[model samples]
Target: MKLKLTLVLTIVSLSLFAQTKYSNEFMNIGVDAAALGMSNAVSSTTSDVNAGYWNPSGLINVEDNQLALMHSSYFANIANYDYAAFAMPIDDRSTIGISLIRFAVDDILDTTQLIDDQGNVNYDRISLFSTADYGFTFSYARKLPVQGLNYGINAKVIRRVIGDFANSWGFGFDAGIQFQTENNWKFGIMARDITTTFNSWSYDEESFARIQNAIEGQNQELPESSEITIPKLQIGVSKSYLFHYDYSFKTALDLNVRFEQNNDIISTSFASINPALGFEFGYVDMIFLRTGVGNFQNELQIDNSESLSFQPSFGVGFKYKGIHVDYAFTDIGDQSVALYSNVFSLKLDFSAFR
Candidate 1:
């Protein structure tokens, strides 16, 4: 009976928690609807404040100060995700940006374990709490001495809180470069968490100790420690093909790879390459339709089964005057679990105001 109870609790923990080898997993989720809509293939073609998150060097393409906001519902209303960013040009060759992202779940049932003198279980003691994550970024980009080349960097701070039980703070930095050709082709590379971010965690020791003791006896080690996040690199290319009367098609592709210690997902110093492809069709750069597919990996094993494997995304956007509205839906595989998300975004271009 004891063995069976342990197995059940383990299964419940795996199902309720997200499993990741790195810290601050929430930050790994894409921020803007426009980017996610393109399956995160905009590393090279990002042209607005969202560039701060994708590729800061792309901020050079913004003609004026821009503000971008996005909101998404994930996993059938299990959580709320939001993002906001602002970008401003300092001169013809320099730009600055600021961004904030938050992900949270509220009013979770916190249950208490109770037993009477006869070891009878009690189920009436349940409370509620919240879990949240926040990220703040400041960025700067400058056109290099060579025309058509740009460089940028970001400083980020992250915070995570869990229902008064534990909290963590982390810091990281990212760098990127972009090169554009006369023929409207663009190439970009970004290195995220280059210094390898570190998260220092603190917990309500007494409470957690008691819980741990009850769950795994007094000999088991409790959860406590600082974690180091690994770095990731992404490379991308984009091009626009023009047809008749300002009609055009924009296409982009990106490859992302992570560098970390030997682990289940990453067995070598460098392993696992994910590819993304996206296309946008537009008339006069106003009305647009987009589709993208990505998250190609061997681990999940692409199939028509109920497993949550690779995700395909679709999006649409419209540009009018100085405002842009965008929407994207991601078909997260595993129909059995019904996991999917919808994202909406709005952008305001200040160039018209100027």
Candidate 2:
């Protein structure tokens, strides 16, 4: 019976993985420390509080209480987003963390119109519509002494709100492993979004009813209610090197490949390549600079025919005493300038772990 229960759970988990769709909105929200670390290609192994989002396995490095906060004013004002996380060690072998990420779109002009039963326009009102997506994550990490490896898992509660049509529930999980080697050589692997769809999303019944009544005369079939897929699969690796310098200069590089299937039920598949490099210079790890690029295929372009292009990014970070700050800017290319022109983010870190 125990074996049977395990098998059932495994099957359910895999089914959920296949059903969830991908959303670019989830990709654009940047984690704080990662934005400073060249978008976190090496994140699967790095020990930091933000690991709750990037790679929970890295949390094993936390030795004390930690707090992190981040905010991004995206696209010069289309929306505002923020992230916060806290972590602490439970014992020598384990660590725990909690994180929250939120994105808000404001002042959307509601163009919905109202009409009378006689088929005459009764009135038009300009109202505001807003959309938000958030997730709460719990993470745990442990270190294996024999293998010199760290492993971790993160469970998340996902929520989405769009004006009156809000989908308020779903769950997902991420797992990762990192190996620490001699001479500063590190290797890491991670699998993200391995769970069932967060299917709590549904239209406001009242809104659907209104639309149904409006179309009653046209004899149109009511639209089928359905849920959206959150983009679900990501696997990647990363590496870093320390420079032999008086100022403690370090260079790091990472490469990540992401895949998605059943994109909006139109494209069959899609892929992305992300490469980043960063340099740190200073005695106290106080100053840093980073740059990276990402490529997408034509099928993934905004208009569907434009050839896929590269997006370039740059960022900077600083550290003083017990506080850390970071920022990054990304250019999404001319074809997508109107919608994603440029994205920027800022993050702050504070921790009692020393």
Candidate 3:
């Protein structure tokens, strides 16, 4: 009987909702299909508008004004997730970006009316509503005086809504840096929620009263009654190679660290690390194929055994005259436990139109 302070369990199934474990879990669902296909291992190689979410420092690579759009559905199409972003160069050495992400489950049954005051079940009394979460990011990246080095930062706002029952707002900050060697090897580090995001929640007890009576004494609450996000860090290395001047490939690896001893593949009393590997192959820089394996976990079985599991993802992309279309099939979260998602994304280079 956990505190049902929110009807968030539905979307939260993806992350095993825990206040201190992974509070803003929705944002962790990678945005770009190309990146998601790579199991979110693009911290060092991301170079476009999508970088606004991946590693803003990478936005310094944007060569033109760009726009991106993406959409995905989870759990048999019960939840819808969408993302959009825009980025542009402010100067030869600086760039700015903005992005929005929305995750929602709509048409949820409102069972408060299922039984009337007469204690009789009514067949047509059910209605529907929705629960949604949104993330807004504003980013800035600038080349450091140090050659081949760049840095970026993000200001984020978060909004959560539970139909008309409750809502919350929060704010946080992130920073990152990317460095490239003359030999073309790349490295990056991103610090998320460096200041610890805190949420201010307000409940509509009157509205929620609808469900309160239906399940009285069932929902428990946290003893301390406050929500805050912990910080996370991602470090990566990547390199690209070309063969015959017509074929090319890039390989990347990222280590994600969170300050807690958890179920990650590599865990200790003080922290945990999850490693992701991504590879991309391109034919003449127009058609691309990508694959990745990550989200490793150890699950305890009913028979008292431990099983290792990992999620594998694949994606394809087509680029023509600065318009990019990408598709991906992947598992999000350890929800990879069984569910997989199909994602599509489109990117446009405004310079092409110019």
Candidate 4:
């Protein structure tokens, strides 16, 4: 039974265009409009509540309690992603935050192949179902005794559901550190899924039995549980320059690496290690413009002849009093299909209102 299920999954995975090794890939999708706009190169440059997702240690830069909300249409409207976060300073030296991210697809056809007693196709039974993925994150950061350094950690719970068919539960943890130089240079390193996050899937046993009975001579049982791991390490650096008293520019770069094991073989490919670049220009801390490029997967491209694949992002932001609004346009590139994503975010500073 296990072998049968494994064979089916291997075939399906081969049929898919994406060649990702990890499950719950949505977790890596940048959350806030500002970060996504910057192509997720904010690991070292983030200073808002959104920092909880990018680099939690950056939360040390948040001076006031903040609430952030974001929504985006992904994959040309095929799916939707939403994010929310709240960060509050426990003291001048410590900060705590919580964040939620959800990705969902609606109205998917659930089909079953019905067969007659004589092994002839009776018909196709179809119904509607939906699929969703969710992650809840809790974060904490504190300034290190070493003056210019801060350390942070995140505990996350993951859940994935496919209508009434199957469900998965996962737990993961992340750790990060940030250093700020007196000259305004910021460096960050984050270990994502440091404990090797695992998802244990449980299928509908009754439904499986029914399907098996429906097909003559098919008596395979469903596997009780299957597990997959997610893990990665990322490092970044950023610098902000003040061209004038009221104008400044910030540039950031990030390098991501992951280690994976297949059949007792461990490997790391250059194509698997991604690099990101981002730039942001601000005027009097009120108006902002940003652009970024990253997510290179040339090595992973099934078609070696295909051009390198990368996404470019651009965004604008406005800030007034304690309210901030941001908009970002992300190009998903033409990888078998032309896809694009749009993100919008709002942020509130409670201290400013008070």
Question: Which number leads on lDDT?
Answer: 3
| Candidate 4 residue-wise lDDT, 1-354, digit = tens | 443453344224222213235667888887777887788887877777988888889888889999999998876686889999999999999999999999987775433334445667543644556678899999999999997899999999999776676777989899999999999999999888888777777767765554455435644545435455557888899999998689989999998777753211123543246788999999999999999988765434465453456778899999998999999988765234567777899999998888
The estimated TM-scores of all candidates read 0.86, 0.75, 0.93, 0.84
Q: Comparing candidate 2 with candidate 3, which one achieves the higher TM-score?
A: 3
User: Where does candidate 1 stray beyond 4 Å?
Assistant: 1-20, 113-125, 213-220, 260-269, 300-309, 332-337
Candidate numbers, best TM-score first, in rank order: 3, 1, 4, 2
Candidate 4 minimal-lDDT segment of 10 residues: 10-19
For model 3, state the Cα shift of residue 108 in Å. 0.4
Q: Tens digit of lDDT per residue, candidate 3, span 171-282?
A: 9999999999998999999999999988776666676566556565633331222468999999999999999999999999999999998888999999899999999999
lDDT of 1 by residue, 1-354 (tens): 543353344334322323235677778788777778788898888877899999899888887889999998787887899999999999998899999999997776544344444667665644556778899999999899987899999999988877666777889999999998999999999999999887777767664543454545432443545777788888999999989878999899998787653322224665657778999989898988898887754343357433224668888999998999999987655223457788899999988777
List, residue by residue over 1-354, the lDDT tens digit for candidate 2.
443343233223222322334432453345774454354554544678877777788888887778888776666776677788899899999999999888876765433334455657443643556767787889999998766688999888777666673345667777887776666566666667655344454556664354345334531233223444443333444444555543554455555545544222123457544554544444546677666555333445566555544455667777775666666665544235643423333333444233
Candidate 2's TM-score: 0.75
lDDT of 1 at 328: 92
lDDT of 2 at 180: 68
Give candidate 3's error at residue 65 in angstroms. Answer: 0.5
